[model samples]
Target: MPAARGGRWGRLPERRARQLQRQMQAKEERIAELETENAVLHLRLAQRLRLAGTAGTRWREGLPQRTRSLLRLQQAAQRLRQDLRELRAASADLLGSCRDQQQDSLSRILAAVQSAQHHGALPSWRARALRLEQSLQELSARFHRERQRRRRLHNRLVELQGNIRVHCRIRPAMPAAAEPPDPVSHSSSASGDVAHAVDDETVLVRCSRPGHHAVHKTFHFERVYGPAEGQAAVFADVCPLLTSLLDGYNVCIMAYGQTGSGKTHTMLGPRPPGAAQADTGLIPRAAEELFRLLSEDPSERPRVEVSVVEVYNNDIFDLLAEDGCAERPGLRREVLTTREGRKAVSPLTCLPVGSAGELMELVGAGLRLRARRATSVHADSSRSHLVVTVTLTAAASRDGTPEPRSSPSPPQAPSCPSPSPPATGRRPRAPRRASSGSPGAPPESPARPAGQVRARLQLVDLAGSECAAASGARGPALREASFINRSLAALADVLGALAARRDHVPYRNSKLTHLLQDALGGDAKLLVIVCVSPHRQHVAETLQSLGFGARARQVERQGGRGRPAPRGPR
Candidate 1:
């Protein structure tokens, strides 16, 4: 029994040992699975770290390069602004230095003048010094005024950089009708047959003769021909208006004609030899007359101011201002408001002239500055219209009593044989413009006193309206002809409208209209001189001029101031 019990205990122990071995195998398998999962999580975490490092490197690399590029652009802009400021400062400094030098030169000249006055024989140094002083004084004054103006303009430029009103003048062209037949080629025999067959046919006059005919001979058309009539004849029609101007009206006299029609000759006499003269044009002539009338009357104190301007390609230029004084550079048109508020433009320049000599000088200077170019028609054809304005101011007796009358007679056409008498009447006065101001102020207004008579006399030498084929103007001249034709068409339209009494006139169509707005439509007395040549070759041009004159006469009649009727037969 003891041996059997011992065997049982041994069997139980073996079974227990087998159970412990199975439990160990299962624990080992579970530990292996946890180890595999831990390895995968470690691989994923390493990959994530690598991706973050690459993104950080890319961000770091791009930041400084972009920052540097931005810095460069900022630096360039700063430099450009700095350069402009420096240039403006340098210009101002240079002007100041010039003025200083001029003053020193003038002082030395004055010293020399004083010494020369006291000495019996002037030293060469003293004589030179005197002349130098006068020159320097004049130069200094000019520089000073220019500097002030420049400063003002600079300020204005800064203010108006992009705010200014810009305008362009485009001359309208007359739509061409069917070209007329060559008058010379129509044979009389052919005409007679055609006339008989048609019955209602119109016979056209052929002015052109063959080369064999004496009338067909060609003559050189001189651009600067001597005046068509004597000064007396030219002034005959203009005398009454001139008298009114002197009587205290702002008067403007304009010469309108085709190119090569003696506009310059009519306005300005033939150029004199070996002498620089300004008192040759109608402007100077009128100025001389005004002074003469003023000098003749002791009771009247007359003050005259003048402004000269030229309109080129619809651009306004101030001839009186310093050369290259463009307030807004590259602009074609500009407005000039007088201290009184009268506005004129298209490259306009205003100046004040106290005497006939000064006025003449100003006109001469303006002529020099005018846009002139040699063409087939004229040596120095004015490419644009020239406007010279004369403003006359008169003061009557302070007592307010009726002023003494030089001539009691009212305005009347002068009788021939007796020298043309001056105009006699109280000149019509106009309200002072809102733009004119005192002499000391900027000439922002163009208005003057109303009680004081004001007149504007305009002299317009219209560009010749020529066919492109006839003028042989190519390239630039062709362009110029186009512009000229447009301007003339506009003028013709204005005349037609005035003659027809249209309620709405298109005066704002072009620069020419704006420039001539007052003369054609304003209250001031207006005179137009239409010059014609009697040459048979110029018959077409002559006919055109006569037609224009006739139209103008019609306008005058409509306006209640037509030409006086012819007197009864002698």
Candidate 2:
């Protein structure tokens, strides 16, 4: 029995030892599997997921086994439980770390993709912007080329027409509700008045008459303006004339109409601040455009001079007369003639102008000094004719000779009138007031030089034709009206003679005609802007005005037959 007990105890020790070995082997295998998974996760997730070092190299190698005498199988089972808990904790931590790293890697990859997309699109946007700029440049070039071609055609037409252009503008009629009763309206009935613009260049007038069938008359012209048009639109038609003046041709622009017409308004515009820049008149706008053209070529700084004159009561007065000028401004006959026989009336005030603002100042002063009167026909009637002359002289050539200019061409068969399209305009920019210098600055530019091609531009504002009876004139007013009528009649005679191919144009018949002799007889370009009233009361005067315009048009037709044409190359 003792022998049997000893053998059983020995076998029990062996069994326990084998059991311990089996448990150690299982723990080792589990640790190895966890380590391998951690390694793979670290590589896949890169730096984001990292596993902690094993508890110690000894634990990884193998734990020492306990003897049956020191440690029982139950104690071994408890140790195994502790090791299992520790391994599970480590594995849980590793899994949490790997999940966080994976999330971070996904975010980084998304950001990289977005950055690549943005960089790739940069060149496409830049190329589109470049194309827009190139297109704008090309359009600008094409516009300028087309404008040059148009200018050439305009010059040809102007020369072929004998440098004379006739344009008629009809004043708008006041609504019957707003218009006062016509003091001079004849033929009983005050209604049934019609004024129609038959075409762009034709105006038809019809009115009721007690003893006759409805009177009808038609007037034809080169250009016409309806009431809806504004100052800017009218100026566009005159824009090409400026280019001609710049090429060294004398230009005359005259407004003719009865009293209360819009001649003053057309020539000078409404009083300054009350009007918008786009509403300003032709003279001011011309000055602005002229300066802009000059600025284009800074190398040739040209000089500009201006003079203002008024013809009142058959007498000439220099609105800008100097301190040592003629004895009496209104009666002065002082005249100046250059060696080349270019005639200009002297004793008139002449001002050196560098900018449009300065020119306007002089003009305002002249307006104040001009003779005016209030008549029954108009609240503020112009009693005198005003002529504002602007002279431009180009810079001399480097060879001390005048630059070649386009000389006027001889009168030929009338060129087919080109129908001018109605102009579209925008708000004009306000111009900077140009002065000589600082408040008291030095000369803005050099003095006028010789050997330069000089050209003249005249803006003539004629007083409205007055009805002695309707205006209720007496005393000096009546005398003034008579003088105005006589002078206008003489002007008509001059036009008729020119149209008839007479030897003399009778330019000396009146002071107004005498002063316009050079413009009428020479190769100077002339533009007559006939202003007509649409009021029923002014029917007779309107007819007379239309007759005058027709004669002027005839003069234009024959190239001002009495006037001589230019010779030699321009």
TM-score of each: 0.49, 0.61
- In model 2, which residue pairs have backbone atoms overlapping below 3 Å? 258-464, 258-465, 259-464, 320-349
Which residue ranges in model 1 land beyond 4 Å of their true spot?
A: 1-206, 210-228, 272-281, 324-343, 346-349, 395-453, 557-570
lDDT of 1 at 98: 97
User: In each prediction, how many residue pairs overlap at the backbone (N, C-alpha, C within less than 3 A)?
Assistant: 52, 4
Q: Please provide, for model 2 over 373-446, each residue's C-alpha lDDT reduced to its tens digit, 9 standing for 90 to 100.
A: 76777767777788888876554566653454323223222122223321111111122233231211011122
lDDT digits (tens) for residues 498-549 of candidate 1: 7788897777666777677656765445566655443333445544654565
Please give the CA lDDT of all the candidate structures.
Answer: 0.52, 0.68
Point out where model 2 deviates above 4 Å: 1-154, 160-162, 175-180, 183-193, 211-213, 271-273, 323-331, 395-450, 556-570
